[model samples]
Target: MAKQYTKNLIKREFLKLLEEENFNNITIAMLAERCEISRNTFYYHYEDIYMLVREILRDELEKVDEEFNETFSWEESLLHAVSFLLKNKKAAQNLFRSIDKKEIDSYLYKICESVMSRYVDNECQSKTIDAKEYDKRLVTDFYRAALVGLLDKWIQDGMKESPDKVIFRIGKLFDGNIERSLRISENLDEA
Candidate 1:
């Protein structure tokens, strides 16, 4: 439990540092100093700064699991997730704009893919979506690509609009019937 407590402290301080500094310039030594712990102590919990980021991101992403259930509207679930992401806007921006854009992009894509996969599988059971097992995977990947592209653009655009707005407009790609219907046209959030 002591290690868990320390890990939480480390995650919080890491996010604070991310909000204040760019990823390129922030170092583990700086983070440890900010947390009032030795560099060795920081390393004991995290391999490096990016490891801390991954842990923090996992925690953030996990918060919306309850929102993923059958009770909430898909848009509401999406809004809740995006709103949580936007809560630490600066931290998210710094992380996204880092040198390892690929890893971060992949993480975001995975999250979207998971959400879309569940949605498709659940809906297709009742014939709402026309997809076989193999095709479902492909379509989910394609949709994930769209979401990732849009999110990347939002990051590049300095998040000019709130993530909820972005999600809403993206949902519109399915013509606002995304809740009950699944159709693939085009989502221009990347454009």
Candidate 2:
């Protein structure tokens, strides 16, 4: 219990610091000082700042996944995920600016892929598409990449636009697109 508490304390302080300064500017010593723990304690919980950030991203993904399962709406799930970054705008922007682009891109890809996969599955089931596994995968991948690109741009632009409006536009644009893609893939396979 105490161990978990210490870890959470470190995470909180780290995020607070991220909001104020760039991730590269933060150090283990600074985090330790803020948490009022020894340097070893920070090391005990995380190997380095990178690992800490990775864990936070993974946790956020898990929360988004859980919420996605409950709501079964891809738009809502996406909005929920983006809302985290929106809520922590400064921290998110700082982290994005300081961290390796690959790290953030990889995390965003995972989130987009997961949400898109679920959406494709639900759409296939509802539309009675009977899409082949390959077709479904292709459709999911296409949408996932598009979604990831959209999110990457939004973050790069400092998240100026409202997430609700962005998601609503995405929903409007994607309506029936999945079904069309599936049918087209099926037709290609038949041809």
Candidate 3:
């Protein structure tokens, strides 16, 4: 448990700094000082800022996935996942924006795809859909990309939507019957 404690401490300090300063402005000495650990101790656990951010992000995802049980629906899972990230918005914003890191997006995508893929495996339609698992992955992966890419765009656009508002819109985005959201095309008979 000592290792876990050290890891958590490092993550906590990293997050604290994120809230107060840009990620680029944050230094190892500042992190070590904030955490009340020596520079050596900080270096002992994490090789660099990027590694620490990645570890903390991956750990956060695992904790959230475990907390929610075997929730398989993409929309429901996204609500939970986004809620978690929104809870730590300052830190996340700093990590993503300052670090120019898409690992967070990629990490979230991997978690989402893993969960959704499992659900798909169990809900195989006829012999047809089940036989096309690769095709199914393609569709699911595309949808997953859209979900994450939209959020990235929103954040990169400087958070025009709060986490709550984004969550609400995402519900609409994935509520199915998406054709309704499109402008109806007018058909002209041959003149």
- The C-alpha lDDT values of all candidates are 0.70, 0.84, 0.66
Model 3 accuracy (lDDT, Cα): 0.66
For candidate 2, list the clashing residue pairs, or say none. Answer: none
Model 1: colliding residue pairs: none
Candidate 2 — which residues are off by over 4 angstroms?
Answer: 70-72, 183-191
On a 0 to 100 scale, what is the lDDT of residue 60 in model 3?
68
Q: Give TM-scores for every candidate, taking all chains together and pairing residue i with residue i.
A: 0.80, 0.91, 0.76
On the 0 to 100 scale, the lDDT of residue 180 in model 3 is 21
Winner by TM-score: 2
Q: Name the lDDT value of residue 4 in candidate 1.
A: 93
The candidate, 1 or 3, that scores higher on TM-score is: 1
**Each candidate's clash count:** 0, 0, 0
Q: Which candidate is the best by lDDT?
A: 2
What C-alpha lDDT, on a 0 to 100 scale, does residue 180 get in candidate 1?
A: 38
Alpha-carbon RMSD, candidate 3: 7.2
Residues 107-158, candidate 1: write the lDDT tens digits. Answer: 6775676577766676665546554456556666777788778777887888
lDDT of 1: 0.70
Instruction: Flag clash pairs in model 3.
Output: none
